[model samples]
Target: ERPEEKLEKPCAAVAPKEEALKPKDMDRSTSDDDDEEADGYQQKGVSIDDLSDDWVEAQMKDVTVAVIGNVDSGKSTLVGVLTKGGLDDGRGLARAKVFNFSHEAANGRTSSIAQEIMGFSQSGEQVLIDRMGTSTANSRNQTWQQVVSQSERLVTFSDLCGHEKYLKTTIFGLVGQCPDYTMIIVNANAGFQRMSREHLGIALALRIPFFIVITKIDIAPQNVFDENLAQLHKIVKSNAVKRQPLVVTSEDHLEQAATGIYGKQVCPMFCISNVTGEGLPLLRSFLQRLPSRLQDSGLFKPPSSPAEFHIDSIYVVPGVGLVVGGVVRSGRICPGQHLLLGPDKVSQFKPVMVKTIQYKRVTVEMAESGQHCSFALRSLVKRETLKKSMFRKGMVMLGPELQPKAIWSFKAEARWTVGFDFSSQSILNCALVSAHFASICPAAVCGASRNVDVPVQLCRSHGDQD
Candidate 1:
């Protein structure tokens, strides 16, 4: 009886003129019995129909780009220079700013998946990282909320591992983050190598559109750079890749790429030097205009739908307790809200209350779709302690409106194949084959149960059935 009353008061007192999923807590004043005052309040209310499309877009605009390439290809350096607003010293200085661990900095290799954001002003100015050191204690110079708050637009880059040993980690970052686009780094002197092809193939297989960037032009000989550039052009135009390559050297080429690069048909290539800052401006301009594909497809919009969050990574902070981190798939989440967290070992979901919500290390009022957030949750059931061991990868936080299930069993028809190998990932008779299907998507296979059909086809690999 008391819970019903508590819900009714918030619904009745707030005027519809307020933004949907208002970040700040709405004033919960006692209801008045006066008829005239009620009439005035009704006049101020606004509905979803009253808001324009532009208003909804202005509220949330986020684009994610995954930086992938072979080891020693300057992937991290490019991301560091782009977000940190600094150039390399030619001795691995710029990339040092982006490394997470001291060993990564010392070895000059990115071993883990790192994310850094760049905010763009309304007038087309790059928001550079300001200040430094552990006083702020974040990967970026300032907190993510501060950068996002100061800019009209946000661009997030997933700095992925490029070594052959970390191939699994690279795949997880690519499929998990669901970037709007992928930026493939190519070393001008070394040219496109084996691991570069692997990254490109993964991006292509997942149907993710991408652009190519040639780095370290300052040190590479002119002849060597041209040879690599020619090889890249030929590959993009080959029967396998089948995408038109546009070498962006001027503003005109940039315009052409911007108009048609959204799809997987056209591929844009850029040549830049981290030391000299040659083609950085052109890259920055394109990033500023790059549209969020999710927004264009109507997936990213007003957070009026039932809220959902998938936990991709988990952390147990010393002071904050256990925190789960992931991207908001379709709606908004706020602190003190109730959500179902689950499908643990026993296929059970525990109702938990979000104690705090932080986006990129800064506390935020509300986290919307397309933003990466960390949630500190508290169990709603009294005396129930959520053991960290129970929570597994691919768990989700669902709203009450959504009905979830733990599908421990399902039937699928495997296409008949001759001499096929099921030994790659041990995906014989399960639900998902690769990490792409494991990305915690909307149509997850309960196969994780949305009445969706997920089919698996085995493609030939290394002249062997796989």
Candidate 2:
């Protein structure tokens, strides 16, 4: 055998071994790099999972407030000013911005369950901006989605009707809409009207924490404002009500009020001028600081639990067959997940599949607990066109395990630990009746806040500015 041939054979064997060992060394180095990167990331105090913008936005905190008051008390006007960054013309130019109907605009009153969104950035900048800067004469409102997308924390206002004629709708707003807080608007000139007392009594009876807003200070005389303020302090602190008034004039007072707003007797009051923008900043700050009562009370369920959704309204989209919009009370809702939609007229639930989900006007693949979502649904059963007509507001959408047989009548024990009266009885009866009046539709409720006045769509996405 030749010496050269012998050398070549050994060299080839050595080459194969080296090649085999190379990938192993490379694999170790690659894994080491990943581990080191992950370690470095952890050291920085942030989760890699949270880097997704949608996830962060979906989890943003939102507070829902129901604005209630007597006729011409300025519920819509206050909301419009805060959200649109526009001042009222004293002729309800701002009020006209939030009206849901032509008649509402014509009359300058909110007659339905109307909603508006005002967002705050992490730095506390309002999400809304006047298209024409520094122009108080008019404001071109930004789209709700645009405001939502820009906001880190959102404040939702459910503007209920102020007139006695719309009392039923207001009842629906109070009971079914599930507002976190209620702001009772009082006219300084009126000095606490009849409906104002009724609303205050209702809030007290329901144990819903409330605050007062005295509007029209720009036109209201100082004596009238002082008189109304004194009246509020008197009524709120009375033995029957048992709440203390903390007039928020500074940051210290606001912090104190927000800290105890839930399950506490601290009722914060503000004097607001929708036209002159007096005391507006303080109210906005309070709203931003307002804690969510639902979140604190376990009513804001975690997404890990079984899904429970309350249907408030239904609509048929032109492109999509049927859609349901409501609040997701518990668990997670994902597109393509199977769920039960029911307690129909026959007290039976229908199996359904969620085809799409939208939150805050942005398309979402999954909706977590405490977010308002619209599910574009596909009925498991062969249903005809106009499937939406079959569903109603009082219905519940449940995860299979949570479904229960429908009952026409059932007796349950409830503890009425407080003093009761005929008014309370009527309120309770109204609650039962309102629960049955399932078609008082809201365009949608955005859960990230208790209810963002807006749209929920199934097989559809709704445009904003409601």
Cα shift from native, residue 20, model 1 (Å): 29
TM-score of 2: 0.75
Worst 10 residues of 2 by lDDT: 6-15
**Global lDDT for candidate 2?**
0.66
Task: Look at candidate 2 and give me any clashing residue pairs.
Answer: 372-447, 375-458, 376-458, 376-459
**Best-fitting candidate, scored by lDDT:** 1
Model 1's TM-score against the true structure: 0.77
Over the stretch 284-390, how does candidate 1's per-residue lDDT look in tens digits?
99888887777664434446666778788878877777889987776677666667677554445567767778876777666776677899876665556566775
Task: Return the TM-score for each candidate structure.
Answer: 0.77, 0.75
Error of 2 at 218 (Å): 1.5
